[model samples]
Target chain A: AQSVTQLDSQVPVFEEAPVELRCNYSSSVSVYLFWYVQYPNQGLQLLLKYLSGSTLVKGINGFEAEFNKSQTSFHLRKPSVHISDTAEYFCAVSDYGSGNTGKLIFGQGTTLQVKP
Target chain B: DTAVSQTPKYLVTQMGNDKSIKCEQNLGHDTMYWYKQDSKKFLKIMFSYNNKELIINETVPNRFSPKSPDKAHLNLHINSLELGDSAVYFCASSQRTGNEKLFFGSGTQLSVL
Candidate 1:
């Protein structure tokens, strides 16, 4: 079974400050990693994903994440945050071996709070 | 235009009632999925379809069923809804294969009273 763990449940940051949301996963085979953002009362929006080729992946709204195979981690980061960046972020994984069903397993989620 | 859309953004019904949530995607993707977000904000995959064929059906109760008329549309029907059935259901779609990112609909907030 594949599972994702988001170390922090909530993160509070000041506007224009840098932030990082930690995510780690455990899976027997290869997997695809993703970050999704959910605004207030809205569905999840794909922020970015790591399939292969590069360790660092860039996403919308100046967000980026790096995949560390050895560490089994995919941590999202931003150099600076804005009030609009505040939202719930989820880390998900899909095992490459599950074929088409490879349903995504999401973490508990981290709520980003940006204060002005 | 919205890549994915679900009807009845908010659903409020009495217990033991039945309801259905409709979802349509115009992204021309061949894969669709249904997910449930509980009150605690834990997102769980309920079903998945590829080319209108069932691909994944989690351990969801028999009370929940999904229908996909075509590759672009996947609908969810709930039977004899209970208070525990209240949740936010999201419809998502992605390309058939290879590193694809899912596009999700606004979601249907079902509240069983």
Candidate 2:
């Protein structure tokens, strides 16, 4: 079984400040990583995904994440956040196998509250 | 145009009532899934269907049933609704091969009183 852990539930940061949301995963086999953002009462939208190739993956909305194989972590970071960036973020992982069904295992969401 | 659409975006019903939420995806994908988000905003996969064949069924209660008539439509029916069943249910779809990023619907917020 594969699972994802989002260490923080709520994070508060001032406008224009940098922030980071931590994510870690555990799987018996290789897996794919993705970040999704959810606005208030809205559906989840894909922020970015790490399939193969590079370790540093850039996503929409000025967000980026690093895929660290040694630590089994995919932490999301933003250089500067605005008030409009306040939203809930989720980290998900899917196994990399044929006929995987593409079912994603998601972590408890992390709410980013950007203050002015 | 809505890639994924779900009907009755907000549903409020009394306990013991039965309800159904319909979902349709126009992305021409062969796989669909249902996920539940609780009051605490924790997402859990309930079921998955690829080509209208059941592929993944989680440890969800039997009260919840998912039906897919074709590759583009998947619907969920619930029986004997309980207060614990109140949550936001999301419908998503993806291509069965190469590209696997899921496209999600706005969600149906079910409130069982």
Candidate 3:
């Protein structure tokens, strides 16, 4: 079975500061990785995905993640964050060859607290 | 218009009671899924349907059932609910199966007392 692990449960950073949210996954076969953001009282929105592309993937809101196959990591990074960037972030993975079910296994979320 | 929508943004019911959550998608997607988000913010897939056909059913209890009346609608019904079921339920859809980007609804927060 595939599983995802988010190293940090919470990340606190000041506005205009750089931040990184760590994520690692364990899978027997190839997988598709994704990062999603969820604001308060809202559904998750896809930040970005790595699906047979370049190692570095850029997403909305100036967020980017690098897929490190050797390390089994896909850490999200932002050069600078804003106050509105405070939200719950999730890391998810789905098997590349799971008969097209698209079932996602998510890790425990990381809360991004942006302070002024 | 909302690409994906779920009814009853919040539901409060007593244990042993039954409840239903409805979902619909206007994105014309063929695949729909139900995901449960626990109190710890862990998300797990519970069920999925494609073109009104059940394709994936996780290790969910029999008390929880899903019905898809059409390709655009999927409804989840739970009988004899328990406190453990108190969590946010999300409905999502994809243009197709296999690594497609999923669109999620706002979610239904169910609280079982």
Candidate 4:
């Protein structure tokens, strides 16, 4: 079984400041990584995913993440954040070897608070 | 045009009552799923259906049942609603299985009074 760990539960940042959300996973097989965002009382929205190709993946809203195979990490980073960027972020993983039936395993989630 | 929608955005009922939440995805995806988010904001997968066939059923209680009448719709019915069942339920859809990312509904807030 695969599991994910999000080191921090909350991250507070000022507007235009850079931020990073750490995520790590433990799985026996090859896995696909993803980042999702959720506003207050809303469902999750996919921000970015890492399937193949380059380790550095760029997502919407100027957010990006790098897949580190050696460190087993997929950390999300943004050079500058806006007030609108404040939301809950989740890191998820699915085993590629499990075929199409693979269900995503999500992290505990981190709440990003971007203030002015 | 909302890609995914769910009925009764808020549901309030007494304990022992039965309630149902309906979900529909206009994206024409073949796979759908139900996930629960507790007060602590922990997300857990409850069920998944592919082409109206049950594909994944997590360790959810038997009181909770998921029905997929068609590819674009999936509904959840909960019996004997308990305070512990009070949480936000989200519906999602994907074009394929593992490789596909999910599009989610706003969610239905269920409160057991």
TM-score of chain A of each: 0.98, 0.98, 0.98, 0.97
CAPRI-style quality class for the chain A–B interface of candidate 3: high
- i-RMS of candidate 1: 1.8
Candidate 4: where are CA atoms >4 Å away?
Answer: none
**Each prediction's Cα lDDT score?**
0.94, 0.94, 0.95, 0.94
lDDT of 2 by residue, B1-113 (tens): 99999988999999999999999999999899899999999999899888999988999999999999998999999999999999999999988833388899999999999
| Whole-model lDDT, model 4 | 0.94
Please give each candidate's TM-score: 0.97, 0.97, 0.98, 0.98
**Candidate 2 — number of clashing residue pairs?**
0
lDDT of 4 by residue, A1-116 (tens): 89999999999999999999999999989899999999987889999999999999999999999999999999999999999999999999988784558598899999999999
Q: Score the docking of each candidate (DockQ).
A: 0.65, 0.66, 0.84, 0.76
Residues B1-113 of candidate 3: C-alpha lDDT, one tens digit per residue: 99999999999999999999999999999999999999998889999999999989999999999999999999999999999999999999998777888899999999999
Which residue window of length 10 is worst by lDDT in model 3 chain B? B94-103
Q: Quick one: best DockQ, which candidate?
A: 3
* Residues B80-99, model 1: lDDT tens digits: 99999999999999887434
